[model samples]
Target: MRALVLAILAALAVTGHSATVKAVHAEEREGFKVIVHPDNPARELERGFLRSAFLKKSTEWHGETVRPIDLATRFTVRDRFTTDVIGKTRAQLRSYWNQQIFSGKGVPPPEGESAAAVIAYVLAHRGAVGYLPASVDPGKARVVPVR
Candidate 1:
Protein backbone atom coordinates (compact mmCIF):
# COMPACT_ATOMS: atom_id res chain seq x y z
CA MET A 1 0.00 0.00 0.00
CA ARG A 2 2.81 2.38 0.83
CA ALA A 3 4.57 1.64 -2.45
CA LEU A 4 1.35 2.18 -4.39
CA VAL A 5 0.77 5.52 -2.66
CA LEU A 6 4.29 6.61 -3.38
CA ALA A 7 3.94 5.66 -6.99
CA ILE A 8 0.79 7.66 -7.28
CA LEU A 9 2.45 10.66 -5.71
CA ALA A 10 5.34 10.38 -8.12
CA ALA A 11 3.00 10.25 -11.09
CA LEU A 12 1.11 13.26 -9.83
CA ALA A 13 4.27 15.25 -9.36
CA VAL A 14 5.47 14.42 -12.85
CA THR A 15 2.09 15.27 -14.38
CA GLY A 16 1.63 18.45 -12.32
CA HIS A 17 -1.46 17.13 -10.52
CA SER A 18 0.28 17.77 -7.22
CA ALA A 19 0.32 21.49 -7.85
CA THR A 20 -3.43 21.54 -8.26
CA VAL A 21 -3.77 19.58 -5.10
CA LYS A 22 -1.48 22.03 -3.36
CA ALA A 23 -3.57 24.94 -4.64
CA VAL A 24 -6.72 23.37 -3.17
CA HIS A 25 -4.98 22.71 0.09
CA ALA A 26 -3.52 26.21 0.16
CA GLU A 27 -6.93 27.85 -0.31
CA GLU A 28 -8.34 25.70 2.44
CA ARG A 29 -5.57 26.89 4.71
CA GLU A 30 -5.97 30.50 3.60
CA GLY A 31 -9.72 30.51 4.18
CA PHE A 32 -10.72 32.18 0.95
CA LYS A 33 -13.30 31.42 -1.73
CA VAL A 34 -13.56 32.06 -5.42
CA ILE A 35 -16.69 33.81 -6.65
CA VAL A 36 -18.19 34.36 -10.07
CA HIS A 37 -21.04 36.32 -11.52
CA PRO A 38 -24.39 34.80 -10.68
CA ASP A 39 -25.06 34.42 -14.39
CA ASN A 40 -22.03 32.21 -14.95
CA PRO A 41 -22.80 28.52 -15.13
CA ALA A 42 -19.52 27.29 -13.71
CA ARG A 43 -20.11 25.77 -10.30
CA GLU A 44 -16.48 24.73 -9.90
CA LEU A 45 -13.07 25.43 -11.34
CA GLU A 46 -9.65 23.85 -11.51
CA ARG A 47 -7.01 25.94 -9.79
CA GLY A 48 -4.88 25.93 -12.92
CA PHE A 49 -7.71 27.45 -14.94
CA LEU A 50 -7.94 30.25 -12.41
CA ARG A 51 -4.19 30.83 -12.53
CA SER A 52 -4.38 31.02 -16.29
CA ALA A 53 -7.31 33.40 -16.15
CA PHE A 54 -5.71 35.71 -13.62
CA LEU A 55 -2.50 35.68 -15.64
CA LYS A 56 -4.64 36.72 -18.61
CA LYS A 57 -3.67 33.67 -20.60
CA SER A 58 -7.22 32.34 -20.75
CA THR A 59 -9.44 35.25 -21.79
CA GLU A 60 -12.82 33.71 -22.42
CA TRP A 61 -15.33 31.57 -20.68
CA HIS A 62 -18.58 30.14 -22.05
CA GLY A 63 -18.45 32.42 -25.09
CA GLU A 64 -17.96 35.51 -22.99
CA THR A 65 -14.70 37.32 -22.49
CA VAL A 66 -13.30 36.37 -19.12
CA ARG A 67 -13.10 39.29 -16.73
CA PRO A 68 -10.72 38.37 -13.92
CA ILE A 69 -10.93 40.92 -11.14
CA ASP A 70 -8.60 41.61 -8.25
CA LEU A 71 -8.38 43.80 -5.18
CA ALA A 72 -7.03 47.25 -5.92
CA THR A 73 -4.59 47.24 -3.03
CA ARG A 74 -2.86 44.79 -0.78
CA PHE A 75 -5.21 42.79 1.41
CA THR A 76 -4.93 39.56 3.30
CA VAL A 77 -7.25 37.74 0.93
CA ARG A 78 -5.46 39.26 -2.04
CA ASP A 79 -2.19 37.90 -0.77
CA ARG A 80 -3.77 34.52 -0.22
CA PHE A 81 -5.39 34.53 -3.63
CA THR A 82 -2.17 35.36 -5.40
CA THR A 83 -0.28 32.73 -3.51
CA ASP A 84 -2.84 29.96 -3.52
CA VAL A 85 -4.67 30.53 -6.80
CA ILE A 86 -2.25 32.50 -8.93
CA GLY A 87 0.77 30.57 -7.62
CA LYS A 88 2.89 33.70 -7.28
CA THR A 89 3.93 36.00 -4.51
CA ARG A 90 2.54 39.53 -4.76
CA ALA A 91 5.85 40.93 -5.93
CA GLN A 92 6.32 38.14 -8.43
CA LEU A 93 2.89 38.79 -9.86
CA ARG A 94 3.62 42.48 -10.12
CA SER A 95 6.86 41.79 -11.91
CA TYR A 96 5.06 39.46 -14.28
CA TRP A 97 2.50 42.12 -15.07
CA ASN A 98 5.26 44.64 -15.52
CA GLN A 99 6.98 42.43 -18.07
CA GLN A 100 3.72 41.84 -19.89
CA ILE A 101 2.98 45.54 -19.98
CA PHE A 102 6.47 46.49 -21.10
CA SER A 103 6.18 44.15 -24.04
CA GLY A 104 2.69 45.44 -24.81
CA LYS A 105 1.46 41.96 -24.20
CA GLY A 106 -1.16 42.44 -21.49
CA VAL A 107 -2.35 44.35 -18.46
CA PRO A 108 -3.49 43.37 -15.01
CA PRO A 109 -7.14 42.72 -14.39
CA PRO A 110 -9.63 45.28 -13.12
CA GLU A 111 -9.44 45.76 -9.39
CA GLY A 112 -11.96 46.70 -6.73
CA GLU A 113 -11.48 48.95 -3.72
CA SER A 114 -12.96 46.52 -1.25
CA ALA A 115 -14.76 43.23 -0.82
CA ALA A 116 -18.03 44.91 -1.58
CA ALA A 117 -16.59 46.39 -4.73
CA VAL A 118 -15.35 42.99 -5.81
CA ILE A 119 -18.74 41.43 -5.19
CA ALA A 120 -20.40 44.23 -7.09
CA TYR A 121 -18.01 43.79 -10.00
CA VAL A 122 -18.83 40.12 -10.26
CA LEU A 123 -22.55 40.73 -9.95
CA ALA A 124 -22.42 43.34 -12.70
CA HIS A 125 -20.16 41.48 -15.14
CA ARG A 126 -21.38 38.19 -16.48
CA GLY A 127 -17.98 36.64 -17.02
CA ALA A 128 -16.28 38.24 -14.08
CA VAL A 129 -14.61 36.30 -11.26
CA GLY A 130 -12.74 37.24 -8.10
CA TYR A 131 -11.62 35.88 -4.78
CA LEU A 132 -12.30 37.09 -1.27
CA PRO A 133 -11.81 35.86 2.24
CA ALA A 134 -14.48 33.40 3.31
CA SER A 135 -15.53 35.85 6.01
CA VAL A 136 -16.66 38.43 3.48
CA ASP A 137 -20.23 38.72 2.26
CA PRO A 138 -20.42 37.82 -1.41
CA GLY A 139 -23.74 39.50 -2.04
CA LYS A 140 -25.28 38.12 -5.28
CA ALA A 141 -21.98 36.66 -6.53
CA ARG A 142 -22.01 32.90 -6.78
CA VAL A 143 -19.38 31.14 -4.74
CA VAL A 144 -17.69 28.59 -6.98
CA PRO A 145 -16.00 25.51 -5.69
CA VAL A 146 -12.30 25.37 -6.51
CA ARG A 147 -10.12 22.37 -6.96
Candidate 2:
Protein backbone atom coordinates (compact mmCIF):
# COMPACT_ATOMS: atom_id res chain seq x y z
CA MET A 1 0.00 0.00 0.00
CA ARG A 2 2.86 2.37 0.81
CA ALA A 3 4.51 1.73 -2.57
CA LEU A 4 1.17 2.21 -4.35
CA VAL A 5 0.59 5.55 -2.64
CA LEU A 6 4.12 6.71 -3.46
CA ALA A 7 3.66 5.75 -7.10
CA ILE A 8 0.35 7.62 -7.25
CA LEU A 9 1.95 10.73 -5.84
CA ALA A 10 4.79 10.48 -8.32
CA ALA A 11 2.32 10.16 -11.15
CA LEU A 12 0.41 13.20 -10.01
CA ALA A 13 3.60 15.26 -9.80
CA VAL A 14 4.80 14.12 -13.20
CA THR A 15 1.41 14.99 -14.66
CA GLY A 16 1.60 18.51 -13.16
CA HIS A 17 -1.48 17.95 -11.01
CA SER A 18 0.08 18.73 -7.64
CA ALA A 19 -2.47 20.25 -5.29
CA THR A 20 0.16 22.39 -3.56
CA VAL A 21 0.93 24.48 -6.63
CA LYS A 22 0.52 28.24 -6.11
CA ALA A 23 -2.06 29.78 -8.38
CA VAL A 24 -0.62 33.31 -8.51
CA HIS A 25 2.24 34.05 -10.86
CA ALA A 26 5.18 36.03 -9.47
CA GLU A 27 4.77 38.85 -11.99
CA GLU A 28 1.02 38.93 -11.45
CA ARG A 29 1.47 39.71 -7.74
CA GLU A 30 3.66 42.73 -8.38
CA GLY A 31 2.35 46.15 -7.31
CA PHE A 32 0.10 48.30 -9.47
CA LYS A 33 -0.51 52.07 -9.49
CA VAL A 34 -4.07 53.33 -9.12
CA ILE A 35 -4.23 56.65 -10.96
CA VAL A 36 -6.93 59.23 -11.32
CA HIS A 37 -7.17 62.47 -13.26
CA PRO A 38 -5.14 65.13 -11.50
CA ASP A 39 -8.29 67.21 -11.19
CA ASN A 40 -10.31 64.41 -9.57
CA PRO A 41 -9.80 65.98 -6.09
CA ALA A 42 -9.82 62.64 -4.26
CA ARG A 43 -6.46 61.92 -2.73
CA GLU A 44 -6.93 58.45 -1.23
CA LEU A 45 -9.40 55.62 -1.24
CA GLU A 46 -10.19 52.67 1.02
CA ARG A 47 -9.79 49.26 -0.57
CA GLY A 48 -13.51 48.57 -0.34
CA PHE A 49 -14.42 51.85 -2.01
CA LEU A 50 -11.85 51.32 -4.73
CA ARG A 51 -13.21 47.85 -5.38
CA SER A 52 -16.76 49.19 -5.49
CA ALA A 53 -15.70 51.87 -7.93
CA PHE A 54 -14.08 49.32 -10.18
CA LEU A 55 -17.11 47.07 -9.93
CA LYS A 56 -19.41 49.96 -10.88
CA LYS A 57 -21.27 49.99 -7.58
CA SER A 58 -20.20 53.49 -6.53
CA THR A 59 -20.76 55.54 -9.65
CA GLU A 60 -19.94 59.03 -8.46
CA TRP A 61 -17.11 60.78 -6.69
CA HIS A 62 -17.55 64.22 -5.15
CA GLY A 63 -20.54 64.92 -7.41
CA GLU A 64 -18.69 64.06 -10.63
CA THR A 65 -19.34 60.91 -12.63
CA VAL A 66 -16.80 58.19 -11.86
CA ARG A 67 -15.33 56.75 -15.02
CA PRO A 68 -13.29 53.65 -14.32
CA ILE A 69 -10.92 52.24 -16.92
CA ASP A 70 -9.37 48.81 -17.09
CA LEU A 71 -6.22 47.50 -18.65
CA ALA A 72 -6.62 44.66 -21.08
CA THR A 73 -7.52 41.40 -19.37
CA ARG A 74 -4.25 39.76 -20.44
CA PHE A 75 -2.06 42.36 -18.74
CA THR A 76 -0.16 41.19 -15.66
CA VAL A 77 -0.79 44.47 -13.85
CA ARG A 78 -4.48 44.08 -14.47
CA ASP A 79 -4.38 40.57 -13.00
CA ARG A 80 -2.74 41.92 -9.87
CA PHE A 81 -5.25 44.76 -9.60
CA THR A 82 -8.15 42.37 -10.03
CA THR A 83 -6.81 39.91 -7.48
CA ASP A 84 -5.51 42.30 -4.83
CA VAL A 85 -7.86 45.26 -5.27
CA ILE A 86 -11.08 44.13 -6.87
CA GLY A 87 -10.93 40.76 -5.02
CA LYS A 88 -11.96 38.82 -8.09
CA THR A 89 -10.35 36.73 -10.79
CA ARG A 90 -10.67 37.80 -14.42
CA ALA A 91 -13.13 35.01 -15.16
CA GLN A 92 -15.23 35.88 -12.13
CA LEU A 93 -15.34 39.54 -13.12
CA ARG A 94 -16.43 38.57 -16.63
CA SER A 95 -19.24 36.46 -15.23
CA TYR A 96 -20.32 39.22 -12.91
CA TRP A 97 -20.40 41.70 -15.78
CA ASN A 98 -22.37 39.26 -17.89
CA GLN A 99 -24.95 38.93 -15.17
CA GLN A 100 -25.15 42.69 -14.81
CA ILE A 101 -25.60 43.14 -18.55
CA PHE A 102 -28.35 40.57 -18.74
CA SER A 103 -30.11 42.21 -15.82
CA GLY A 104 -29.83 45.68 -17.44
CA LYS A 105 -27.69 46.95 -14.61
CA GLY A 106 -24.42 48.00 -16.31
CA VAL A 107 -21.25 47.05 -18.13
CA PRO A 108 -17.65 46.62 -17.22
CA PRO A 109 -15.22 49.51 -17.50
CA PRO A 110 -13.75 50.31 -20.88
CA GLU A 111 -10.40 48.59 -21.40
CA GLY A 112 -7.29 50.48 -22.39
CA GLU A 113 -5.08 48.86 -24.98
CA SER A 114 -1.96 49.77 -23.03
CA ALA A 115 -0.78 51.63 -19.95
CA ALA A 116 -0.04 54.75 -21.97
CA ALA A 117 -3.59 54.81 -23.23
CA VAL A 118 -4.95 54.50 -19.71
CA ILE A 119 -2.73 57.30 -18.50
CA ALA A 120 -3.79 59.47 -21.37
CA TYR A 121 -7.47 58.84 -20.76
CA VAL A 122 -7.19 59.60 -17.06
CA LEU A 123 -5.23 62.76 -17.73
CA ALA A 124 -7.76 63.92 -20.30
CA HIS A 125 -10.93 63.12 -18.33
CA ARG A 126 -11.93 64.76 -15.07
CA GLY A 127 -13.46 61.66 -13.46
CA ALA A 128 -11.23 58.93 -14.87
CA VAL A 129 -9.64 56.29 -12.68
CA GLY A 130 -7.38 53.48 -13.82
CA TYR A 131 -4.46 51.26 -12.93
CA LEU A 132 -1.07 50.66 -14.43
CA PRO A 133 2.08 48.76 -13.64
CA ALA A 134 3.94 50.40 -10.75
CA SER A 135 6.89 50.95 -13.05
CA VAL A 136 4.96 53.22 -15.39
CA ASP A 137 5.20 56.98 -15.01
CA PRO A 138 1.69 58.38 -14.42
CA GLY A 139 2.44 61.62 -16.29
CA LYS A 140 -0.26 64.22 -15.33
CA ALA A 141 -2.51 61.83 -13.40
CA ARG A 142 -2.63 61.60 -9.63
CA VAL A 143 -1.67 58.35 -7.96
CA VAL A 144 -4.22 57.32 -5.33
CA PRO A 145 -3.22 54.97 -2.60
CA VAL A 146 -5.49 52.00 -2.08
CA ARG A 147 -5.56 51.22 1.59
Candidate 3:
Protein backbone atom coordinates (compact mmCIF):
# COMPACT_ATOMS: atom_id res chain seq x y z
CA MET A 1 0.00 0.00 0.00
CA ARG A 2 2.85 2.40 0.86
CA ALA A 3 4.59 1.65 -2.43
CA LEU A 4 1.40 2.30 -4.38
CA VAL A 5 0.84 5.61 -2.60
CA LEU A 6 4.35 6.81 -3.39
CA ALA A 7 4.01 5.69 -7.01
CA ILE A 8 0.73 7.62 -7.38
CA LEU A 9 2.22 10.69 -5.81
CA ALA A 10 5.18 10.58 -8.13
CA ALA A 11 2.91 10.14 -11.11
CA LEU A 12 0.78 13.05 -10.09
CA ALA A 13 3.83 15.23 -9.59
CA VAL A 14 5.15 14.33 -13.01
CA THR A 15 1.79 14.98 -14.62
CA GLY A 16 1.45 18.51 -13.15
CA HIS A 17 -1.42 17.38 -10.94
CA SER A 18 0.46 17.77 -7.66
CA ALA A 19 -0.33 20.51 -5.15
CA THR A 20 2.87 22.38 -5.99
CA VAL A 21 2.01 25.88 -7.18
CA LYS A 22 3.70 28.20 -9.61
CA ALA A 23 4.07 31.96 -9.22
CA VAL A 24 2.89 34.37 -11.87
CA HIS A 25 3.99 37.98 -12.18
CA ALA A 26 1.49 40.78 -12.26
CA GLU A 27 1.61 42.93 -15.40
CA GLU A 28 3.12 46.29 -14.46
CA ARG A 29 1.61 49.44 -15.90
CA GLU A 30 3.12 52.91 -16.15
CA GLY A 31 2.01 55.27 -13.35
CA PHE A 32 0.49 58.75 -13.76
CA LYS A 33 0.18 62.03 -11.86
CA VAL A 34 -3.19 62.77 -10.20
CA ILE A 35 -4.56 66.25 -10.71
CA VAL A 36 -7.72 68.17 -9.95
CA HIS A 37 -9.70 70.89 -11.71
CA PRO A 38 -7.61 74.04 -11.98
CA ASP A 39 -10.51 76.06 -10.67
CA ASN A 40 -10.77 73.88 -7.54
CA PRO A 41 -7.61 75.35 -5.90
CA ALA A 42 -6.54 71.98 -4.43
CA ARG A 43 -3.01 70.67 -4.83
CA GLU A 44 -2.10 67.92 -7.27
CA LEU A 45 -0.45 64.60 -6.42
CA GLU A 46 2.90 63.65 -7.87
CA ARG A 47 3.38 60.29 -9.54
CA GLY A 48 2.92 57.29 -7.20
CA PHE A 49 1.28 59.47 -4.59
CA LEU A 50 -2.25 58.08 -4.21
CA ARG A 51 -1.37 54.85 -2.40
CA SER A 52 0.08 56.68 0.55
CA ALA A 53 -2.14 59.72 0.30
CA PHE A 54 -5.37 57.80 0.13
CA LEU A 55 -4.62 55.10 2.68
CA LYS A 56 -2.51 57.02 5.15
CA LYS A 57 -4.42 60.13 6.13
CA SER A 58 -7.60 59.64 8.13
CA THR A 59 -8.18 63.39 8.22
CA GLU A 60 -7.91 63.66 4.43
CA TRP A 61 -11.66 63.86 3.96
CA HIS A 62 -12.05 66.59 6.56
CA GLY A 63 -9.45 68.67 4.77
CA GLU A 64 -11.23 68.51 1.42
CA THR A 65 -14.81 68.14 2.65
CA VAL A 66 -14.93 64.97 0.56
CA ARG A 67 -13.81 61.41 1.20
CA PRO A 68 -11.20 59.47 -0.74
CA ILE A 69 -12.43 56.86 -3.18
CA ASP A 70 -10.79 53.75 -4.67
CA LEU A 71 -11.39 51.50 -7.67
CA ALA A 72 -13.24 48.63 -6.04
CA THR A 73 -15.39 47.71 -8.98
CA ARG A 74 -15.81 43.98 -9.63
CA PHE A 75 -13.34 43.80 -12.51
CA THR A 76 -10.85 46.43 -11.33
CA VAL A 77 -7.31 45.47 -10.34
CA ARG A 78 -7.36 47.39 -7.07
CA ASP A 79 -10.71 45.94 -6.11
CA ARG A 80 -9.51 42.35 -6.46
CA PHE A 81 -6.11 42.83 -4.88
CA THR A 82 -7.07 45.05 -1.94
CA THR A 83 -9.03 42.25 -0.24
CA ASP A 84 -6.04 39.93 -0.41
CA VAL A 85 -3.81 42.63 1.04
CA ILE A 86 -6.28 43.58 3.79
CA GLY A 87 -8.17 40.29 4.39
CA LYS A 88 -11.55 41.69 3.44
CA THR A 89 -13.90 41.17 0.49
CA ARG A 90 -15.26 44.08 -1.56
CA ALA A 91 -18.68 43.57 -0.02
CA GLN A 92 -17.02 43.66 3.34
CA LEU A 93 -15.34 46.92 2.38
CA ARG A 94 -18.74 48.53 1.87
CA SER A 95 -20.32 46.84 4.85
CA TYR A 96 -17.48 47.60 7.23
CA TRP A 97 -17.27 51.23 6.13
CA ASN A 98 -21.01 51.61 6.31
CA GLN A 99 -20.88 50.44 9.88
CA GLN A 100 -18.19 52.99 10.62
CA ILE A 101 -20.22 55.81 9.09
CA PHE A 102 -23.23 54.79 11.17
CA SER A 103 -21.15 54.83 14.34
CA GLY A 104 -19.41 58.15 13.36
CA LYS A 105 -16.03 56.48 13.16
CA GLY A 106 -15.22 57.74 9.64
CA VAL A 107 -16.90 58.43 6.34
CA PRO A 108 -16.58 55.93 3.50
CA PRO A 109 -15.48 56.96 0.06
CA PRO A 110 -17.91 56.85 -2.80
CA GLU A 111 -18.19 53.62 -4.77
CA GLY A 112 -17.67 53.97 -8.51
CA GLU A 113 -19.17 51.75 -11.18
CA SER A 114 -16.34 51.88 -13.68
CA ALA A 115 -12.88 53.33 -14.21
CA ALA A 116 -14.21 56.08 -16.42
CA ALA A 117 -16.78 57.05 -13.84
CA VAL A 118 -14.15 57.04 -11.11
CA ILE A 119 -11.95 59.28 -13.21
CA ALA A 120 -14.80 61.59 -13.99
CA TYR A 121 -15.67 61.94 -10.35
CA VAL A 122 -12.08 62.66 -9.43
CA LEU A 123 -11.77 65.28 -12.16
CA ALA A 124 -15.01 66.97 -11.19
CA HIS A 125 -14.43 67.00 -7.46
CA ARG A 126 -11.31 68.45 -5.85
CA GLY A 127 -11.58 65.88 -3.07
CA ALA A 128 -11.40 62.73 -5.24
CA VAL A 129 -8.35 60.77 -6.42
CA GLY A 130 -8.11 57.40 -8.17
CA TYR A 131 -6.03 55.26 -10.53
CA LEU A 132 -6.72 54.19 -14.06
CA PRO A 133 -5.43 51.34 -16.19
CA ALA A 134 -2.20 52.34 -17.90
CA SER A 135 -3.83 51.93 -21.27
CA VAL A 136 -6.07 54.91 -20.63
CA ASP A 137 -4.92 58.09 -22.32
CA PRO A 138 -4.23 60.91 -19.88
CA GLY A 139 -6.28 63.88 -20.96
CA LYS A 140 -6.69 67.15 -19.04
CA ALA A 141 -7.29 65.29 -15.76
CA ARG A 142 -4.20 64.55 -13.71
CA VAL A 143 -2.88 61.02 -13.89
CA VAL A 144 -1.55 59.07 -10.87
CA PRO A 145 1.01 56.32 -11.12
CA VAL A 146 0.54 52.83 -9.66
CA ARG A 147 2.78 49.82 -9.14
- The Cα error of candidate 1 at residue 61, in Å, is 0.8
Model 3 gets an lDDT of: 0.53
lDDT of 2 by residue, 1-147 (tens): 999999999988886853324545665667898999887778788889889988999978888788889999768778789889889887898899999999999989999999999999898788889999998999888998978
Window of ten residues with lowest summed lDDT in model 2? 18-27
**Of the candidates shown, which would achieve the greatest lDDT relative to the real structure?**
1
Instruction: Flag the better candidate by TM-score, 1 or 3.
Output: 1
Per-candidate TM-scores read 0.78, 0.81, 0.49
lDDT of each: 0.87, 0.86, 0.53
Rank by TM-score, highest first. Answer: 2, 1, 3
lDDT by residue (1-147, candidate 1, tens digit) is 999999999988888986766765654465788999988999799999999999999979998899999987556567778888889877899999999999999999988889899998888889898988888888889999999
lDDT value, residue 56 of candidate 2: 93
Number of clashing residue pairs, candidate 1: 0
Model 1 regions lying over 4 Å from their true place: 1-30
RMSD of each: 10.4, 4.7, 7.7
- Residue 13 CA error for candidate 3 (Å)? 19
Residue 44 error, candidate 2, Å:
1.0
1-147, model 3: which lDDT tens digit per residue? 999999999988786752332211231123323434334454544322443345433345425744455655554455433443334555776687677779876665565676677777777877666555556654666653333
Off by over 4 Å in 3: 1-57, 60-63, 80-103, 145-147
